[model samples]
Target: MTVDIEPSRAIPAHSWRRWVGLTGLLLAEAMNLLDATITTVAAPVIRADVHGSASSLQWIAATYTLPFAIALIPGGRLGDIHGRRRILLISLAGFLASSTVCAVAPSMAVLLPARAVQGVCAGLLIPQTIGLIKAMFDGAALGRALSLIGPVMGLTAVAGPVLGGVLTSADIAGLSWRVVFLANLPLGLAVLGSIRFLPEDRADRKPSIDVSGALIATAVAAALLVPAIDATIPPWARLALVAVGLIGAAGLAVHMRKTRARGRDPIVEPSLFRDRGFPAALLSSVLYFAVSTGLVFVVVLYVQEGLGASVLVASLTVLPFSLGLAVASLLAGQVLLARTGPKLMLVGVGLLGLGCAGGVVAANLAPAANLAPVPSLSPWLPVSLGLAGIGGGLVTVPFFTAALARVRPHETGSAAGLLNSVQQLGGTAGVAGLGAVYLHHTGTPGGALAIVFGTCLAIALVLAVSATAMLSSPKDVGQP
Candidate 1:
């Protein structure tokens, strides 16, 4: 006689429960994304408090991303092995504790370490959100569930700088920069309570940790990020670190194949790189993210330090860019994507390059007659930033959609985890690489800003050409 078996995990059947689950997930994500850029607006203030060197400022920005990029794959695997609901709660608790630590941190020594912990917690928290969405909903529900990420992302993008500026300026009980971190507590606590409404889900197959793969990935990221902080080091030392990072990467590739051949889980599927569009899409994303993230860091500093704008004014300068990004992202997904596909991304990137050029010209044209610290220029600043924001909006959806269009259903989880990892990794690279160049020219910030923007513009041009060649073949415009 055949026996019937019931699944161990419960799936949410009611629409309201699923929506509640989604709200919790989005809330968690908003916190993470908010933390990403929020701290950036307050970086100068934090540096002043800590009396840190330029390198330390880069560390403050880049350290969070270091562990975040490294821990992502393993974190997702753990969620599958244990339970998404369980892992998410634990992660949020850790995030809350870490935020408290950050708010009370007495020194850069304390704050930086706390920020690193926060990154790992964020790494853990993010994967569970995507996993829950995938597990809870299917068909139309899944589509709607996934669609929420875009707007939430855009909303957080707009909110991060403004929130940071407000919190820092508010000086809540003279907390100043600490408010940016403290701000997370209420949202995290609320989400922790709300998560109980979500269904508990776990993978059916037994999940195993890829310890070796994780270590190698961490080492590779460390080697890549560390040298970017201390640029005064000898050329040979930097090259040696680069060599070490490349070697570690090679080892990781070999290890993944061995793991796959042994029928064990790898951090990522080695074969996913074989797709024609996958590698280019991945490269473009890294480039796209590097320029996008590095631009924010550079612009914030330029406005504050170069132009001598107050923190609040500096924050306001970024507002137009963020708004443009939201509007463009909405249009890209709702309208332009159906008609233009990857070509739209090319246009966006090109516009971003143009925007960078415009910024350079505006900064160059700053009047010497203005005794105020802030530059007296025409409307170029807002217009240029708005152009960059729109460019970001145009590229975000198409790149993600195209990258995953050919991904197999079974590999979706791994693909998503790996892509997110790359995105974080790319952000780290932007801060470390570009921030180093910016710091090196601190005495001549105008020249430094010029060089940094020039580098981004060059990368954007290359992205446009390479992406065009790869995506040239006629495909369905509405495919994504």
Candidate 2:
């Protein structure tokens, strides 16, 4: 039987359907990003309400990201094999159901698992966002559609903490921290309804799923992640877990090579890394995301538990950072990105290091009493975070554009999936790894924060040095 595998015509740029579909996609994108960081501001509240252990707090965030990172490649491949619209709808339904579970969860025990399911659903939905863009538009039209995503992403990141704080503090219907997830129900339904407006595209030649590669990759990620979750664990035991993780990584490399040799598609295209610049770009993406997530998670705790800031106040304290990120990301994507991709990233990374150093210094300057109220330190706190945010925009905006610069049309889904998955993985690792450090030093919040922020600063500087030497020129990234 013949299947409806391709669109008859590109959707017109001015058509109502096109805008509606774009709105749906953007809403979905916003919701996903919002959920990612919204919990940050509410995390302390959630911990108090649930009476959860410090580790549970970390799990609440890390659990969502781990599955998300692991599932993205397969999620993208599924969209290619089936249809973008079909997979997107399925994922959204799962997300809504999972959100409902999260909203009603009576304890941390139930909530963590529900959040994992939500992350998986997010993984499934996110890749289709980019894949649909590729399927719907081409040439300059494609560039225009894609350009809008950066600003939207920045806004969502800026808005997520504020929204979370408002919802949690307002305690809508007296649901408290649960309102964050409950709020998504309406938006989820709206996106589901608008799915009809999105263009549907499927691969003409369906490829076999790389089941073994996926499983092996999961093993690799898990071997490191599971052990890192608990700071109380013995260092010797954690080292063993790291060894197992290394073995799994080696196994994944071997299996992918075998798959390629057998002329079968692997979850990750080994050929993609053959480009010297692509691998460096991918590593830089990982470092950038890890630093961002880790810093946010730690800062939320420091602000609320250490500085005694209310949820709203804590969220507002971080607002300037988001504002800086939004402005810088828009500028980078629009102007600096085309002129000096690597150079701009270097500047961004350098700023990130300096910003992080400033935060570390601010943490040190704060009175170690652990009972100080909001506005504890100088204006330097937010300023430093804002500088870091600008660096974030500079690094990320150009990174995505540069990494996918040379990707072929047929490889679009795979490339987007791999890149996005790495980003999620970086976030997952950051929360898990740095959260451990934060928890281990909880008795002294300032000291813990100083250590974590210091680590971030070091990583940023290292990446800046590496990117300066390794990343390609702006022309190389922008060329077809």
Candidate 3:
């Protein structure tokens, strides 16, 4: 009935109960992480089997992310308005059921609907994981808890490719690509056992669900995202999609203005953006991931084409990056929140820029032919990735830490939603813009990839400068 999370306490002296809660939350978060990612690898397989046009395949993937992205803020608000434990449990159950539907889907028609439902469930669970962490831990201990989050994200980011390859290759149950969807089942069930032991969190004051604001937001996001994912459409169709998004955005703005005129709570508060740090961090994330995710795409091509490695070999080579992140993410989180805060982010972003540039140089020079045995070009990719681990960890881990400190208590849901939306938008744009850059210059694919990343490196340097500007003068990062 009521959900007011007690500020998170310190990580309990190592204990089974504390560990169980941590694991449960991690598994829950992974379901979202793995699902968002793994399906992309499976998309081509589904297209081959389901006999859909390329657009349908895109829809199958976009339907999930679009809804999930559109729904995240509202989902977090729902948990706050109701109860996170109840919502989390319900979200997990719904997600599992949807996974089964996707597993058993006979055609694109059946599968796409299931993906949308699954995304909605993910939107519900993902933010609640952060909310639960907020509820359960505080101060330095909270930093530790937040730090643990990055590793699961890191694991899934790397594991998605390797795991998808294995499932597609094995086809042990004859499920082929569908095995990826079905994989969520065990992870879902496992979370149930752990969630049973999770402490319940209910807000003391429930806010009214802003249905109008939610509908508007969804329309705006889907309008923009749906078109971006469907690349084969005519130029006019593409323009139409952009127009639709602009109109939807306008409608949402007008609605919010009306709500504000009447003194009701708008889903996205204008005041939240007024803070210097909020815009600074948000813009930084947009530019950073735009380059970072694009780097992954380019590196995949560079290793296979420029370096002349097999797909399997190229995929496996990326492991060092994740392994590096798993090692350093939490430590970086501790350093950011405890010692440096904004200054830490500036350093992290700076390293990311340098590593990306160096990695580019390395990839160009170091080919598999140069290294012995397995062969590797530019061994710097892994080292670059390792350095990125610190940068990525610092930029992200402090996000929630800073959000909680700065946002009005009631707007945490919106804050979380905004965070997810920007993060996803950045990734989506990176894939599109960078992928386009690579494709448009297919005759010189390696050059295309490098150029895209080189551009991103410059942008990242600019972001680092912005962080320095915002965090130093105003003390806007820690103080509300």
Off by over 4 Å in 2: 1-14, 370-375, 406-412, 472-480
Q: What's the true lDDT of residue 187 in model 1?
A: 93
Worst 10 residues of 2 by lDDT: 1-10
Candidate 3 residue lDDT tens string, 264-383 = 767776666656767766676677766665556555545544455544555555556555555556676544467766456766787777767866675455533422324445567677
Per-residue lDDT of model 1, residues 278-391, tens digit only = 667777777888887777887777777776777787788788888889999999989999998767888888788888888777555554233265556447878988998899
lDDT of model 1, residue 180: 91
Task: Tell me the TM-score of model 2.
Answer: 0.93
lDDT of 2 by residue, 1-480 (tens): 012235564576667787678788989988876788889889889989988887877788887888888788888778878888899999999999999999988889899999999999998898788778766676787788887787877888888888888889888888999999998999998898888888877767677789999898888887788777876678899899889999988888888889989988888877666556667767777788889877877787778877787888778877877888888888887788788754687888888999999988887776664454554654678888999999888887777766777765545556677778888888877888788788777456778888998889888877885576446534354234
Candidate 3 segments exceeding 4 Å error? 1-22, 40-61, 104-110, 130-151, 166-171, 198-201, 301-311, 334-339, 362-390, 399-405, 408-410, 469-473, 476-480
Number of clashes in model 1? 0
TM-score of 1: 0.93
Q: What would you estimate as the lDDT of candidate 3?
A: 0.68
Candidate 2, position 24, lDDT:
87
